[model samples]
Target chain A: MMRALSWQSLVAVLLLLAALFQLPLANVPIAMTAPAVAWTTLILVYGFLLAGIGADTFMRSRLWRGIVLFLCAHLATVFLFTLISDENGLARPGFYVVLAACWLLAWRCVEILSGLQPRSRAGRIILALIIPAIFGAWILIIWEAVTRGLGIPFILLPPPSAVFTKLIFSLSVIAADVNQTIFKAVLAGYLMGCASGFVAAILADRFPFMRRGLLPIGNLVSALPMIGIAPIMVMWFGFDWQSKAAVVVIMTFFPMLVNTVAGLAVTSTMERDLMRTYAAGYWQTLFKLRLPAAGPFVFNALKINSTLALIGAIVAEFFGTPVVGMGFRISTEVGRMNVDMVWAEIAVAAIIGSLFYGGVALVERAVTFWHPSFRNGKA
Target chain B: MSEARGNRIIPVLVMLIAIVAIWYAGTYFMNAPFQRDLDRRAGVTRSSGDLFIATMTQPKPTLPAPHQVATNFFENTFLRKITSNRSLIYHAGVTLSSTLLGFVIGTVLGILIAVGIVHFTSLDRSLMPWIIASQTIPILALAPMIIVVLAAVNLTGLLPKALISTYLSFFPVAVGMVKGLRSPEIINLDLMHTYHASKAQTFWKLRLPASVPFLFASMKVAIAASLVGAIVGELPTGAVAGIGSKLLAGSYYSQTIDMFAALVAGSLVAVLLVTAVDVVGAIVQRRMGARPS
Candidate 1:
């Protein structure tokens, strides 16, 4: 029977069973819910499905099958006991236990699937992407089911669906916030900060005096808490994107400057001699050799700064703002008990920040493709 | 090393001189303009030309006087009653305790999660992404939610604030430790395997030792981040103690000097924490025979 259906089909069947069982059981008396029985049945079926997949590959031993069975049984037992003992009419404890079990099982399944030695490179790629994709999806599914099915308070923990709905409903607001926070504040700050840092790095590299005089102070400034500095910037720049931008510039500048200076100096004496032998001027050597060699390190700083800039802008906005920003919305919404809106804002921020960081990383890969770290695939 | 050391001292001295010079010049040149503005705003009888002349010739106004700030610092930090509202020491104590507590909690949780990921490849693949994704949710956004949620659960206190610190602090530790735990070279792993070393033994001896530098580097970052987290936590709660509360209060009252002083205190604390971490790193490097760069 397992051989007749694909593993995806088996998952679909189990999901159907869970949904079907959820109906009548919804009306069952709290004490007589038999949650454990249902959980055990589901676990056994899921375990069998996993074992069947494993059996078609390297999992040839009964011992391996036994381990899977034992884990599933234990989880089922825990869920059953928790459900049976649940006194709350909410059925949260029971649902949570089952959800946790499902999550664990999903995780284990992904692990096993990825660990399988496929016959081809394409298979390997599929395995790599599939495992994380499946795991992430399962997490969202369980999150949605448990939060919605058991009726957790939206204020406390909104379901993924609600968060998504909020995201859709508030797209315009979120987009405007993204524009204000990321486009206006973060981008401006990042550019000015990075440019200044880069220029300072070059100056520091050129003159020993500047390097000696500035690095320690830069480090000191770097260590200044954003919470401490943000308010000062707001006072100076006046409760707008400018203040947030100023804070980001402070937050991002030192790291970029420090990293670039270090990276510039990383060239070996042999390499320096090679550059000198070419009769290259200082500027020529810097642009042709040192800067190219420093690509990875510079990109590292940029990638790090992407996240740092977002963080600076958000936290800076917390001090004071002009009423339309991701940070302002999030802080205000939370105060107003609109957690779903906060989560939605958070979702937008997360997406933007990740994409920003990832974009820098991708550009780094393309620009620094010849670097040892990238070439060796170590980073 | 000698040149680097000498170079460092020169920068330090130069910075001190530059700061002093700036303070002197700022006090001398900027004071008359400020006082004239004040006088004009106060409706003092002076011709515009006279006001300009007064602005140029007015005695330098008090700009903390360097000595005054020093006196205030000493008064606030030492001679004042420890429980006094004006005492920097009391506020420092409150802020430091929370920072330290949060740092400890955060570091432990980070180490634990990192260890779990290191040992379990599946966790490394699945959980690492989530952990990375977790950072995308800005701490500013998370701070209030955490405070509100924990408050509802009747867990509102030092713990909630520390939790925020932990949230901010843990990411660095986890990322750092993951790098550290994975620092063990393949040859080292092979040597452990040849010695029939258990996973735990291999980890303790090979992976953990190799991870020390990374861990300390991360700790430096974590400590600073934790301090920031604690201060931010103080903001929403309106706690009447700690540097954060002091900053907020000073800002509200427009006590610019007090606000600047509180900022100085926080920055000093962060610098001290980072310097301590650097010292530890030096010691660990010496012990490990890694030798300082």
Candidate 2:
């Protein structure tokens, strides 16, 4: 099994090799009239076509045949390069040749790997994990290759390597920004906003008049553009985390209120009747019946608010800020022509937002384990 | 039912009345002190009694009374804009062009990508997560980078700002569409399969119609977001026209009323655009026989 070179595995290995070669080898002076056809790229394309051909030819053991075809195809490409190009180092299609090969090889690997039908649970899991990782990595590869290979200016779109380097170098500044935006402003505002929304929802539910009066007001508030509100919040709260938090609160409050209201209503009449038969009052019924029923809706609000809070904080920072925040860094750095620094801020935001969303989801799973959606593993 | 309807109308009316009453009281009580501060800052000589009189007689406070804003809006849009600078129509035209261009681009790209995802399961899983994750990186952060990158590539023009609008607007469309496309009832899908329909046929006859509601709903959101994107695009780039530049200019000059007026204009544009979508949605919904209650 290990000895067998499945077309995807072969392509992956070849691309890996091509990427390694892309760095220093191309810089070596070679005199050739036309840049040598991107040999590596051609080989990978050949591999892809061969695998396709194999899939058509071998009906029962197509996978195995596809693997063999890919290996053979790449080998033929390498052999052709040796034959057509001079050994005297006359032509240096060097890095371009390698990059082309790497890209084609990577693409073929993705196609082949994505085509495979997983036969086991672990196989499915691995395939699920691997395919996206490969796709994302290739995007980064293309980004790195295009920027470095073409010598694209760093101030424009910095190479991925440069972004990573900036990520390392400006770890402290990035961390401080993250702390200011995510920790102090976003988290605080998110908590306060969500809590107030939830409380207001409960109050609205309790008072018939409030429900009739407030829901429309909530809708209007939700529709108020963040751009309009953020500056006003800055004016009201001063230029600090407090102002940003106010904006977050305004942005997040409506979603939570709407979702929680809808959630509290999720308890069916049958369920409510059952609670009534048990001699439960409104609060008792709410705690026992409606709250649990509302779990999914509340969780939905939390998930939505995670992203909304981040957005509110960032946009609020644009209006005015005390210097150290994610939004401040992103806006200021772009002005300074520090594209890599901007990318670093973005990477931090992505990771933080993902973790925040994932945390809410995880808590939802734990709390609502008995809910049919979670129990059946549907969502 | 009539009682419930009456109950609903009453609350709405009361809320409106209460809001107006508060505004009136705030104007009456808060107006004097606010004007005194303004006069003090402006180095105008006035006794406390004179300040109160000035506050009452002053055409409008710095914040502009609601009536003043309405009159300003009419004067700028209808009366003046038929001629000069600070014309609401002129600025709106600048902003609207970018918004519409961005909306068209974003919608097309979103639909194409969504189709790709719907057809391929692997692409669905892999692409959907990234698409969702893409939004996590705030557009505010991405906008300047996009501007700078495009500038370096010698691609600065109206198109760049429009492209920023497209970037911001497309995500909602893509996500909304993915849901819409996947929303075909299982029985309906099986029925299509029974008829031996091709993939394209099934898509056209069933999924496309099913997605109309979702698409229009998202278009409302996408259009609003696109307008915002165009405005924000104007801000960093120092674009001479558009509502965003107007707001920035207003802020820069401490012309609070001008800032507010521009904001009102922008909000009106957004509201009008959204209302237009809503009307179209209603028509579509009626045509599809899914009219709202």
Question: What TM-score would chain B receive for each of the candidates shown?
Answer: 0.84, 0.85
Lowest summed lDDT over 10 consecutive residues: which window, candidate 2 chain A? A83-92
Best by DockQ: 1
Error of 1 at A247 (Å): 1.1
Candidate 1's C-alpha runs over 4 A off are A1-101, A116-129, A377-379, B1-5, B19-36, B43-72, B280-293
Cα deviation of B24, candidate 1, in Å: 6.2
Docking class of 2: acceptable
Candidate 2 residue B99 Cα shift, in angstroms, is 2.1
> Distance from true position, residue A152, model 1, in Å?
3.1
What is the C-alpha lDDT profile of model 2 across A155-236, one tens digit per residue? 8777777788899998999889999999999999999999999999999999878788878766655544556566656655
Residue-by-residue lDDT tens digits, candidate 1, A23-97: 322223544746566556555544654443444333455346334533543454344334423332344343444
Q: Could you tell me the fnat of model 2?
A: 0.36
lDDT minimum window of 10 residues, candidate 1 chain A: A80-89
